[model samples]
Target: MGELAVRIEGLTHRYPEQNADQRALDAVDIRVRAGIITGLAGPDGAGKTTLMRIMAGLLKPTMGEVEVVGLAPIRDANALHLKVGYMPQKFGLYEDLTVMENLVLYADLRGVVGRERTDQFERLLDFTDLHRFTGRLAGKLSGGMKQKLGLACTLVGKPELLLLDEPGVGVDPISRRDLWGMVQSLAEGGMAVVWATAYLDEAERCDSLCLMSDGHVIFSGEPAEQIERMRGRCVHVRDISGNRRHFLRRALGSAQVVDGVIQGDNVRLVLKEGVERLDRALLAKEPDATVEPVEPRLEDAFIDLVGGGPDGRSVLAETTPEVRIGEGVDRKAVISARELTRRFGDFTATDQVSFDVREGEIFGLLGPNGAGKSTTFRMMCGLLRPTSGDAHVMGIDLKRSAGRARQKLGYMAQKFSLYSNLSVEQNLKFFSGIYGLKGQAQDRKIAQMAESFDLGRYARVTAGELPLGFKQRLALACALMHEPPLLFLDEPTSGVDPVTRREFWMHINALVDKGVTVMVTTHFMDEAEYCDRIGLIYRGRMIAAGPPDELKKQAADADTPDPTFEEAFIELIHRDDEARRKTEAAA
Candidate 1:
């Protein structure tokens, strides 16, 4: 191993609360070395963020010995600040400031100047691919671009140790790849990097991983060694008839199935011990079904260690009536956009975009950062007026009758837009009132939502005080309170853990089964498989649209037989970029 950069012994942290079981970290021990990237991996409320905060000297541990580069974090925080660069999950960037202004401000605060500062600034701009956007206001930048700018600002002083908390949370796939590349390069230059994330795939890429669960360190070693424990237990089953949800429900019901998830045209399962193979009779039940053994992933090991399968509860409360499509509803196209276009000043955000979302279908919109997917989504949801053309939601014209069109659909924004200072119960009541609910009806709905979302214990807790997973659940509950026939979710599951993500999809599948149509935007490429179809947008244009399998086939060249969704997405984006470059040259 390289030189030691961070060391912790018997670290413990607890928030002051009325309850005694509120420990955020319990006797955690860790060692981080220079010249490599270390990952802190776990589910929500697993103490990863708390540990990172302690290490960064932002929070003092309740009880522990912590040292960073031989300096005590708490006692010598002032001295350590000069040697460490820390970026919290929510990095504070001045929204009104231009990108260059923010960089300069941070550099000045860190006391960086002269030729050394110029050299560092140039390298950071080049690495983050933000040189062209130096004059753009931070408020106008895309989610991924903002993250890159935050990281650039954090590196102003060229610190020896870097701590990033869920830096790639809402970032797109292409941007996420670029961020990881920059991080690896930083580590190679003898800097120690500690990255906290809920993504197991990312953990597998780290030089070493520390797995946390329930406020304690459960495992610490190489990711491959952890995955090796689940060898021969993972299996892949294909259902070509598009009955993945039905198959998933059945598989999870079985006594031998420990965990199951829908991956592109297939369901990956982790079988219980002594179960060598799935019953062939089950495969014969579904038309064109097949099964095969496959290697285990870090997620598989994580599920096994967690000791529970995906939660099967419906997102809607039990007290709520079952949702049903209106009689004689337009089953062919629940949503339709015809030649939609949107412009700001001289720049076009969306250009001539047209698509149709059928009833009960889960449609996904995918793109890189600043690719105009959000613009198209906003027009369809009646949140923004199109510069030309029209969109119809549930047969209601969005341009002519936006209020009526909005009544037929539920919309969840990219960020958690609920009132942060209000209690969870209060937020539900507030939304209920906004949706025209009243008196007994509002009270009943609030009670049902609290029960369904498992928020009863924290009903009085402020929405902002909840963990990331619970925050997502609360947002979803508010969106579904009115039970509209159609739902619009914009990056709903970003920054969520694998288990919580599975549970979220389970609820979505349940809703789809009950005849609800969903249109969503997400950066997680694997989530594209859950949608019946996907549309890829690039530079204010719809470049491609098709089912996941069809898109994968189109992306595969002579060398690759079958590319993963992420690989396919990258390939398509690169092709579009190359085409645009050629057009500009010809012009």
Candidate 2:
């Protein structure tokens, strides 16, 4: 190693407020060196964040050696703070303050108030590309810009070692790439950077990785080595006809299949170890099925380490009846938006958006942060009224009667919008009541939801206190309580681990198989691949709409032959941005 930036041995930490002797980190050992980026990755409650805090001297480890820059973490914390830059999961940015104001405040807090401060501020402003938006309120910036601002604030003191906790949690792919680029540049400058993330793809970008689970370091080395172990085991299954979802369901259910994810028009399957090759028995029924080997990804290796998720089945669909369209509803266009427009003050949030979501299909409204997909989603879900145009759910005009349309819709907000103080059971009961469920029906639905999501053990636990996976389950259960024919999910799997993500999609695909329509908005480009069709929005306009494969075709250029979903998303967004710039120049 070049130089040890952080060193820990037999580190153990337990919160004074935690119930029992449950340690956040137990007998953990990790190291970070200068001039490289080290990734900290794991599922929720895996202690990645705890280790980061301890390294930054925010928490004193109960036992073991903890050193940063060759200095003790707790004994020399005052001096250590000057050499370290730590950004918690929730960066403390004053939303109402301007970008420059926030930067100035952070600089003052770091005692950088002089000519040196001015020079540092200018350098960081250019580094972060926030000069033009210096006067903009932090709250008014997009998710990406806010992250840049947060990074700029953290760099106020010019620290040598930087600790970032889940910096790309809700950021778009492009912004995430940009943020990573900045961090990479810092690493090149010999600053030790540690990035903790839930996204496996991000972990792959690091120079080295330390994968943790249950308060112990599972693997600490190059991510590629870990991924190499999963090679030759990854294969794609393609049906002669174009029913990838059905094939995915089957592949996931196979005895030999350990994990499967929908990729474009095929289902990528990871076979169990020692399986050598895909067995003909896997798709014996479909003689025309094609099986081709593909490269394994960090996610595949991650799933292998963490046990297999739900057994490729949705318990919620076990006892629920199949969705059936009632009278006066057009099955072809279960959800239709024509020239939809919504404005807030001087900004047009959704500008002349139009799309159609066919019955039994999972239609995604895909876009970057502040791209207006969520605004269009709100109009489509009847949560917000459009300034012009119209939206119809089940053929009912949203402009005329949104409340009536909502009776047939189940909506889940992007964040954990459910009551935090309420227990899981209480939230379920509240949502059931909100949907007008009553008496035996409400009781039966609650019981079914609890059992379906395997939330019986956590029924009495507060929604806010539950882990990330359990929170997703509770939110999904609440939205599904009424068993509406259409479900609207806003970033349903944000910040969740891969296993929980698989389970969530398994349930969604199962629901769609049963004829339920789904409309979703998500920042994850990979998750967008699972949608039947995508409405690609940018800057308050529907830039493109098609199946995931078709969208990739649209994104192909001279440089790329077959672009990944994230590449396609960025390409499409860049195209829109370039076209808009030309238009503005012409005007």
Candidate 3:
């Protein structure tokens, strides 16, 4: 329209292995206004990243044209680069360098110097709240702090156009809030930003959005309108048993009735038809069903847009039961932790944390940045030996029998741990061997994983060459190669699209049914619903633990009748702040 900050017409990009006709971005056309936050929302392999890269001048389209700030990214590469700040899913920070050193290096490389440098650095550090950590190495900082530093480095020169590719993935709620505040301020200052994210709620916060799917733009407009279009039809129902849940989900899918998702004992459904029809149908089919109308959310819009498979139960139909068969600590209690603690010098990362994980349960360890959730997880998985206390996996002590504990546990870190230089098949082989999964057992497991995750299509492709979604899936497959009774996932879905996340969790849920115990950490609060039990950490302490609804009740304030998890979380943090302030005043 009037001097668009970003304009794209018929843009297309295909990977080297992809057929020439198969485009990652198929004839996509869009325009982003100045001083606005435009979200590129979609599942993994949806081409949001590709589209952003093209607009940022980091990539060239196979067809069509893109212009940022009225200049072509390719032909006007230098000008576009100067006006744009591009941050990939990964920070690309030097782990050995201090936060200040990294910032200074980035600033100097961007030609910022002299008197302006000091002011710029101070302003950035203050905004990120990383001034105190300036002397700490980038690698040593917590996940949220490192992400803030990355954002600070990108904003060093205040480029007119900012392309953030999943920048807030794995970030804590407080850090996420802070980052969004910064984004709002930048947009108000007339800097157009294109933020690609898998978090639907985050996407809902944008001024506008472009929903990409299968390498094509499915919808583009304000998120409010998009959400409103699917209103008054969503409902939630709670249930148990994998077979029954699967049956219900399939039934819901077959009816073309509405969008549905399984959240441990609860399934959220959106009626494609009217609510009356959905009610009538459900009542007729399962008269005993405990169904109630719940407030709709962005996830409803996501399910409505993405949907199940061609037959309706495409994703849900592939459910596999959690596998928890093993001898030790009553197979039902797959993971047990009692007063776990880890200390690094003067810092106590985990402070007497205690929790028990049932076999076949999706247990989530959640907290804000610096809350000690990761440290606790590492100890449980035997990655880090706790300074004191205990952690047992399938009845084996993590500290005393780290090797045996590891054998029964599948672990996936924040980053993809597979070899980048090797092909997908090679990575699988390497991990299989490490787990001692030899001959027929390994081959059978690999084949099943390949088919389910669509790894066969990219078996020959180098792990490094795969897209972010594929990389995540491969990492997951590798982790599960051992078919362990327990799983520890640290923000496994941090940077993937909604569909990819859903798909990945679909597979995980299947494993849960087969008795696999999962303990995962995630920044996406909504994902907490999937866990059978949840532990909320704050300032190195376990503040809340139980079912999501129970914790929500516990975290709720006297003023709110029924607070959502996000609201409860905010309330808890505010209370913590108040208590800290009171302690300081007394001191």
Off by over 4 Å in 3: 1-3, 15-17, 238-253, 263-265, 273-276, 279-290, 309-328
Residue range 1-587, candidate 1, lDDT tens digits: 67999999999899887258778999999999999999999999999988988888889888989999889988898888888999999898999999999999999888999998899999999989999999999999998899999999999899999999999898888888889999999999999999999988889899999999999999999999988888888898875585888788778877778888877778888987778888765565586777778888888888888885664556463344556766765778889988899999999999999999998899999998889999999999999999998899877889889998887788888888789999999999898898889999888888888877788987999999999899998998898888788999998888989888887888888888887899999998888889989999999899999998899989999877789888999999999889989999999
What's model 1's lDDT at 486? 91
The local distance difference test score of model 3 is: 0.79
Best to worst by lDDT, what's the order?
Answer: 2, 1, 3
User: Model 2: clashing residue pairs?
Assistant: none
lDDT of 2 at 475: 91
Overall lDDT per candidate, in order of appearance: 0.88, 0.89, 0.79
**What is the C-alpha lDDT profile of model 3 across 1-587, one tens digit per residue?**
22478878988788786887787888899998878899988887788878888888878788897878889898999877778888898777889999999998998878889888899999998888898999999988877788789889998877888888987887887778888998888888888888888788889999989888888888889888877877677666654334444544464555646555655456766777444545455445455566677776765777677764222233321434445374446655668888888899998989999998876778999889779998898888888999999888888888889988788778999877889999999999899999998998888777877887788989999999888789988998899787777888998887776667766766676666666778999887777877878998888888878888787777766789777677777777778789889999999
Worst lDDT 10-window in candidate 3 = 308-317
Pitting candidate 1 against candidate 3, the one with the higher lDDT is 1
Cα-based TM-score, every candidate: 0.97, 0.97, 0.91
